[model samples]
Target chain A: MSTPFIITKASGESETFSLEKLRHSLLKSGASPETTEDIIEELERDFYSGMRSRTLYKKAFSLLRRRYKAQAARYQLKKAIMELGPSGYPFENFVGEIFKAQGYTVEVGVILQGHCVRHEVDVVAENETERILVECKYRNTPGFKCDVKIPLYVHSRFQDIEKEWRKLPGNHHKKIQGWVATNARFSGDAIQYGECVGLQLLGWDYPQSRSLRKWIDEDRLYPLTALTTLSKSEKQRLLEKDYILASELVSSPHCLEILNLTARRKHQIQNEVRQLCGNGD
Target chain B: MSTPFIITKASGESETFSLEKLRHSLLKSGASPETTEDIIEELERDFYSGMRSRTLYKKAFSLLRRRYKAQAARYQLKKAIMELGPSGYPFENFVGEIFKAQGYTVEVGVILQGHCVRHEVDVVAENETERILVECKYRNTPGFKCDVKIPLYVHSRFQDIEKEWRKLPGNHHKKIQGWVATNARFSGDAIQYGECVGLQLLGWDYPQSRSLRKWIDEDRLYPLTALTTLSKSEKQRLLEKDYILASELVSSPHCLEILNLTARRKHQIQNEVRQLCGNGD
Candidate 1:
């Protein structure tokens, strides 16, 4: 019967806070029904008009971390991804790994000759019948949406590259597609222009059923930064060394050697990584 | 003769510094041949391999300022244009004024409905036979160039607007054009793409015969910031009140009244403005 509390989003827009959305997200993070209800009750006491969504998220994350480490890590997947940057290279590699898991041969950064000029493409993925060029737009700040200008510029780049590609001996019969993948949402105009031009846009929660979040979760390809046991600097070190995915550490255990953690600490992190990745020891 | 004294450009490229180029620019700024020779000689003594061109420019500007006031202001036209912003609104207005000088009805910062969405266009100019949309890209930094992405994006926006414009009555007969104007230079790829797509590109010194600088000098449309008689804060105050052009003051002397200057001080600025604009008293 009362007016719903208004919350400020990262994009500086205000919206009425929905209890159902919060409850659904908590359950999605593997929180128990009782724990989810308890957290909801606790959060209700702190709810006020004009509260920032970021503050609300932090409060929930800290509360969850006290009860369950792995669940808390899972709950903060979006934030953890943002922590991978200040630079965009690591996010590009993370996107490449996602495509790699889908059985595509991926190159993270490569320079390709366009008809007019040379372009440094973010990710190039290839399969038997198709080649995909992806421009990964990474934003460390939450609520920064990729605008229409991004896809508009990207479409032109694709056109140039596609023209050069068709001239190669074996490329005429292959399908060449352009994709724009971002760690943020797409503006309505951006999505409209992208769809109109046939440039596949994959954002954080766009295309609802098969977004970046869904792909990461479905493939069990969590970023190394998702490990709660590792410190922020440790995650940055691994990212700098081109170790982006936690699943990467499973294959190349030697990557941990660079961190120089004690044997006990290393085992703890490895155990957390394995469990979070759904790989049973 | 000694490896041509490589000087670094603002865009981070190194090129052989040409004495002829320096002489040409100084002469273009209305410097006497004797003064130009003296300044060039002073600069040569300080020239070294790997020295920044910015340092070379400062040396010449300082030497010129000592000898001539108005000519030095003309010499630093490019820098004065850059001082117009940290924001791009004033630059947009300046660009609008350029089109207005050509007898086109110009609007700055107008929102137009596109085929799918709305766009906040920087400048819109309409003449009897032509309607042009200009995107003013202003960079406060010395060496930043408008790249291909800019024109590519502007082309898409223009396409959307042009489509909508065609649906309106009496628009089909007019030639619709998109322009990317910048106070700096354009990258080679940007020029190539813009030319390929029929988008007009106007940069600081592009097209050689009719660049932004040439247009300003030809029309005597120097920005108020170019007046050395006014202090930086006074120039900023004028810009804040939309007094972008020095000619604006000649038409409406009351704009200077806003600065609360002494009668003598006001006369000093008015005299300088008239001299720069060739409105000889």
Candidate 2:
């Protein structure tokens, strides 16, 4: 494009569309450099000033999908994570799996007694040296950022729980940590307060190299909802049965039997899951 | 009234109906003892097993309304306070008015910088020797309790603000306090945490003698929405214009001019406000 094209963002603010940013995202989705360049060139032909960023995203996503299903699914990972909730339970479970992947024994949705009161902690992960309490702030809306109130509340809750934990026998040496994880980004104040209070914050694109998105991509721990082969209802049923991660179905194919799918369709779903998770031979 | 009737409360818990409780409430609404007994007797005739307590309340309210409009309004104060919100702004303003009635100079919905971050406090009140920051938790739904998280978060926010307040040149001698006010009741844990951390909690029926209800009644600071003479839309318009209390209209009768209400209707509203607020000389 000769002149800068102003595109409306999800937040209703307009910014100049950058070819370099789009190219980087496409490449990050596992597309080849040539493929990313080709997609960007095609997209540039249709670019118009004042077009919505959502429309541009849909166009790019469809173009990517036509070339590779797994890459497209990976590209839409953030959106898929959002689809996990009208309720926050699924996201909490997803965070639990991430901790489990990192070799911690994780518990999802446990009510533990704090020093002052009982707190319903979203995820608790424990290893030999340390125990972590996670509070998940899930917002399904695009561009919704977790603000300072979240980290402030999470810090107090952790302090209460940590105090009680420190008093228990055989817990004298174990380090206690608080974490605030979200599928969305965190406001500047949220990060400042969280870090100042020694709380770990993991947002979709935060912490630079070790965000929630990075953690998911690191282990191919894609939520079941990210499988394009599965119907929405099919994925929801799997989620209801607590089959949250795609890797779970790959490891235990018997879980798919609950869906009562035809042999061919079941095989197709298994193939897609394995391919997407990089588990297929 | 021969066998005890089971009534479902708003929380969906069933309890045996108490005649003494009903009688006490009726008498408390400014009804004469004889009038209270008459209403109870009439209500007992229609009572059945497995009836909702809401039905009992409605029946008593309508029966009381037939005798006195002002008393009936007082009887429905809790529900009226709830009706002040689909948004919490009106409730916050009502809270400000309550603090004002207690002889404090108050600011509603003010954003003050905390030691760590800025906070949008619901109501800030100051007197010669004290400053109080209040967080109003308004729940439109009946039977919703303010859980421990509410107070835990409020206390942290208060601490952050208090830290900054302590550094202010003239605040050294002023007693800075944090308060959580709710239209709903607080969970036991919430009250415990709040009190443990020196935060004052005011709920609909909490602290026994000095609850939100008692405060409203102490000065006859009935919300404008509690005036039976005003329609919902009329009250809403007044609320939108920041005229939140019936006493607001009593002091500035000309505020009614914005509603374009008829002169007779205006006089009727003023008369009811005066009678309800005990300001009818």
Candidate 3:
């Protein structure tokens, strides 16, 4: 066993670095135990007593990069996601897909007429049971909670449309409800306000298994932005073609005919899609 | 019922297009039943008596794009996977991770000394029971089966190494075994040859519950390429840093600090990682 070393965390507080944790993370990444041990041994050999964890992490990562590029790639998924922007059309489509899965006829960027004004609804979903005017809020970065003010604004906006649209039996909606949805979670106050006002809220984990993430995974409706293999312009082209989810490849894989991809590349992706979402759950 | 349309099959045969299938697929993609009906109706209204299924698919996709870009994106997932090359290092890393979970100490792209010469091994794994040399074969395109020649070559290679290394007193590996793995399925003769020669084989679906995909899903060790949100370079950078699995992001999301991402973006990825792999099964 190596002596304990103090590591300055990103939080500015210092904590003792555990070689065991590093080894565990490495093993979790699929590195052979020998490779994991070798990397740890090397890291310990050069490690100083009072290094910042950031530097330690970087060194270990750098060492892993040099020894096994493939293993390193498997461990850095969260960082890879930062490359995909969630506050965009892709996420809105992702959210819309979930609502659709729950049996809602959903549309993004819909326009609904209010009593006193015209409101641009993020999503408007309709079904035999009820019609829901949804606010499709997308966030690129994580940790942003949909706050109370948003619910307050959307609540008023729904009322504005409800006040005017409710007058007519068959305008855009006969009788509709209101929902505020996000790929991120809602704040405590926002949830309170939404529940208090009888407004429905949906998010990644807002309602547990009934949340947005659950629906997407349940149907394997992963967004195009979630795929790590696409280039920016390639993703743009797919998006331009309205191909949002990786499962979309399920039906329209021929869409790749337009892109300059090798047959083997196409086959690999198709196989991956089949592997990921080819079969029905 | 709408009039049936003609669709040209790839086999050079024509078939009648089922509107119901289209409706089911669209609805499965999270399109509301009404929107699905409306789109089907419009496509039907513009229906030429003998339009190709391809033409009809294009028309429906175009309309869906115009009306619901989000929904369109959801339908385009297959094409997206081509953007990801599944027959490569990341995938090999993915495979290695699964084996690691199965209690193997693994190494990718290893070299072993043979009776006559030295051979490069795709993966070298060991535990208390067996020391196995593996050949990781990945194919980007579908329909390319691993033929008998693959296992033959791998068996020969393993036997060569075994002849020399078996006499060693605890080199990196003691007495060794041979296994050939591919992401694609094996040919009939290939499986026959592997079984006859006593060589182990693994693929996406080769051995049922012990298949590579089954193992990945059982552990929730999904490839980051499955995420639609990451860009090419971002995935590369993360891969370079050894971050390839979505689950890895759950523990050390601050790894994104090197990338120029917003706070919200980081948070979204963290949330997604948690959603994908947070609750351990």
Candidate 4:
């Protein structure tokens, strides 16, 4: 932060630790621009050369923690998202809810007959005008990207399902679409291929303004994994029971009894869920 | 044997059962040329119209079974190959042994570091001149084919591993190669893509002269699943214990005790293993 100096990265590699990079990371954590600038400038004056990136990251995290709880939580957003997976079913349900919020009737885990065989489609959201089949690609880490092959696979599959659909008596009336949604980003080729094939894609920050994050944020439909009150196993239990979103937890608080949580802990989780979803009731 | 007419297939679909097709199949089963022709000719006169494929299959199976038991076993090659899977590890180990028989040192389930991350390659065989990385795509049923996408995925993975190898201080000397071996056929595009990219592909009968079946046949290294003496659970146990090849079973016949077979059954299994591996002594 101070005078730009060299530091050791987590990859056991060396890089110049830039103030701009720190400021950008801070801004991403939801720090106010003015405060981010002030913190960076202050850290720079006090900092020494040859620092480890981990130490620098910790220092920034602590500063954000002291400044704002919400910003601190936002800093851990990637980790929170990652906690939702290993299986993408919960993410599929969450995406389905987002579509449901927008007035679409959603079905999760629909098995449709393809040309060659039957395929388990993640989400099917339909309204009077159209039906959309969505494939949810969930990765446990941010580093993994959905590549061209996924789009190719999905496009081929969509064609098969579409072929089978035509044989049904009244399937021709509604417009049908195929979509691939991922919490992670798509590789460059995936985006290009999907665009070329007219396959809709919605990744975390992809297509900029109307991405998966935007839909969830707008609807205030945060997944249970986003709650700090839930442990990894607790979150997993909730996800296993198909309680995907925080709003869903509020809707069926009775399900918490199966978790065998302490009375105090259950109350705390309920309070957090209500606060996160809204205080409308 | 009777003359064949239209027959219902395994898919419950109907097709004309041809004499030439039957002869080809018999020859593929390793039947003598004279007997194969005679069997087909004899069957043609006795067969009826509109027979189920299973009945025709059984008639041929009985004829071959009576003539040469070993050939009958070979005739069940597709089924035996299928029995090796659901998980391709046993098949992969068998492939490793095939390469081993050809005088290469083999490693199975080798986790190699790739450029982005690490990948667990099914088999890695090395000789003085070259090192080969093999990916075994095993399917439980013959209906599955290694499609164009598989080559694309394997090639991408190979490239990543190759990139990492280049970064290693002194890995340039050994010629590195990547291959994909499946117990089934490759889709047209898979072969096209593999040939175009110079990624070696060895499917059951792909690439003409050099196929997985050819290798196994040439080496006399049939998998344990080829033995009829073992039940499904017994074969599974053998596979789980990593006794992949019939030759391995012969070398360690004592391992057969855990299957809880009658003395006659154990003796029969041992005899088959010995015959299959050509260990007459």
Calculate each model's fnat, 2 decimals: 0.38, 0.46, 0.00, 0.05
lDDT of 3 by residue, B1-281 (tens): 35566777556578887878888878887778888888888877677655667778778766665455333322332222233364477656766776787789989878766654456777778887688787888777867788655765576566657767867767544556788777778977677657765788987678886876666555766655545456677767777776667667656776677678888887776655554554421
Report, for all candidates in order, the number of backbone clashes: 0, 0, 45, 8
Model 3 C-alpha lDDT per residue in residues A1-281, reported as the tens digit of each score? 26777888888898988878888888887778888777787778677766888888788766665555333322332232333463466656656776787788889888776654457787788888688888877776768778655765677567767877767766554557888877678987677757766788987677885776666666766665455456677767877776776677757778787678988877766655554554421
lDDT of each: 0.87, 0.88, 0.68, 0.78
The residue ranges of model 4 lying beyond 4 angstroms of the native Cα positions read A1-211, A215-281, B1-67, B260-264, B279-281
**What residue pairs are clashing in model 4?**
A2-A44, B1-B43, B2-B43, B2-B46, B2-B47, B3-B43, B3-B44, B3-B47
What's each prediction's TM-score?
Answer: 0.74, 0.73, 0.36, 0.46
lDDT of 1 by residue, A121-208 (tens): 9999999999999999999998899998999889878988998989999998899999999999999999998887799999999889
List each candidate's DockQ score.
Answer: 0.30, 0.37, 0.00, 0.05
Candidate maximizing lDDT: 2
- Comparison by TM-score, 2 against 3, better one: 2
DockQ of model 4, rounded to 2 decimals: 0.05
For model 1, the superposed segments whose C-alpha errors exceed 4 Å read A1-67, A169-172, A257-266, A279-281, B1-67, B260-263, B279-281
lDDT of 4 by residue, A63-107 (tens): 665455434344465666788878777788878988998899999
lDDT of 2 at A251: 92
Candidate 1, backbone clash total: 0
**Model 4 has how many clashing residue pairs?**
8
lDDT of 1 at A123: 99
In candidate 1, what are the lDDT values of residues B1-281, reduced to their tens digit?
23468889999999988878888989998888998998887777777788899889888877776557666677888988988998999999999998998999999999998886688899999999999999999999999989888987898788888888899998889999999999999999899888877899999999789999999988889999998888999989999998899878778999988899998988888777777888321
Question: Model 4 interface RMSD, in angstroms?
Answer: 8.1
Q: How high is the lDDT of residue A189 in model 2? A: 91
